[model samples]
Target: MTNNKTILVVGGTGMLGKPVAQQLKVDGFNVRLLARNPEKAQKLLGDGFEIIKGDVDDPAALRSALTGVDGVHISLKGGPTEADFDHMDHIATRDIAQAAKELGVGRVTILSAYAVSEEKADTPESRSKLKGEAALKSSGVPYTIFRASWFMETLPMFVQGKSISLIGNQIHPLHWIAAEDYARMVSKSYQTDETLNKELYIFGPEAFTMGEAMKIYAEYAGVKVAPISIQMLAVLGALTFNTEWKGMAVLMKHYENWGEDGSPDEANHLLGAPATTLKEWCNKRYSQPVNS
Candidate 1:
């Protein structure tokens, strides 16, 4: 079925955003991308998408992108600093919602973390995400907030050369959803008005601890998993001046403290549950030679 509606995607070039943008196009919606680098977006997304040169930071760019669009999907990620999260996640989402409200957009969908809550809004990222969700809610525009669990795709990130590092003693059993599954659900949400103005908690079919998931991935990639203390990671990050490393340390610590809350029954019933298992994902992802 073809959708006559046009949807503008913010942060289309990111790891998670790319799949949703691609799926929206595959689902027959007129997909437009608001990217900071149009050429890079074109290179990654190819033809078939309307690539607009702009980012969420620019209100003029956001206004231009929101104009005449049926909906806007926001999938943004911010950094190691508190200011970065406040600006990129919170401020950008607020700006986008305001623009969508002014333009009379039909829907606004955003990606959020499952752990985000008033009590758990201790970290900058978590606080920003919670504030962002509130911004969309108060914007008076029809909205869908996808509070999703951890992604299977992030497993590969733990691998550094032939060794994989486990930052914390993450005992929580995560419903590791695939990017494809999340993207499919995002597209499906746009098809029905019933999904509008609701916060959906997306989860995968199988549950596994971070260590368990890493074991499967490590076996496939011919790597060994080693436990690295959070303090050690922080030290390494500080010594190497790598913000990503420091950020990962902070994130791992957060997850170690808080487990995934809320039920996925609503999201599953509405948009279909994610069925991809860790082994299934590994078979598809690491079927060939390991990259790293």
Candidate 2:
């Protein structure tokens, strides 16, 4: 079916991309997915979804994918094993931006993480993401970039047996936004012309320090949440210096320097803040299912 809006989603099979694409489709936009593996995309995204086969690494494939699309949403990542494997985020972003410009695409919206700035892009991952953001900015297409805080999923990872590993001091407050909430914002970005050519920041409804956040989880899990020592974090950092484990340490180091909370009031006001409360989300996640 032909529609007034056509959006091409790169990395559509990914965690953030899937929800964003689904939300966009639900909002009456014609959504086309550009995935490296069309078979996998089909299996995950199901039928009646338009998908073109392409890897971001190939400029020719990107050119083919950009044709006839009104706008583009990039959900690509450059970190850890994937960064070493493909280098797609840094390299392919430029290619995609160029292709979008040449093809006369109207809008380009990128899903970027918070804490990325001109001075603080210290790690390889941050540097790469910044490059991608820059490429879209200079592409001359009206672009909307939303830098979001940590995801809700990150909380579960801290759970290890009876204790949780608190990266850094657990003192820094972080606004842990839900992926679903962020997806809604992304879907709205394409529909709203006001978002054009602007960079916005988004976060969860509530901001909590790791210690405070863990208390909610611990209460729900019926267990005590305790911090992992700075000494242990240091040891892990040393052991995993040349490996992907080091990346988490790098992130923790960054968090250690972040003293304040991420403000989401303005961004939330503009995009209509997500209705899910932290306690509500926790209850849904941790609560046991009723017996049939």
- Candidate of highest lDDT: 1
User: Candidate 1: where is the Cα deviation over 4 Å?
Assistant: 288-292
lDDT of model number 1: 0.90
Model 1: residue 215 alpha-carbon error in angstroms: 0.3
lDDT of 2 by residue, 158-199 (tens): 777876666667576777777789888988777678888877
In candidate 2, position 117 carries an lDDT of 71
Q: Which parts of model 2 have CA positions greater than 4 angstroms off? A: 81-86, 161-163, 221-226, 229-231, 237-242, 259-266, 288-292
Which 10-residue span in candidate 1 carries the lowest summed lDDT?
A: 283-292
Top TM-score hit: 1
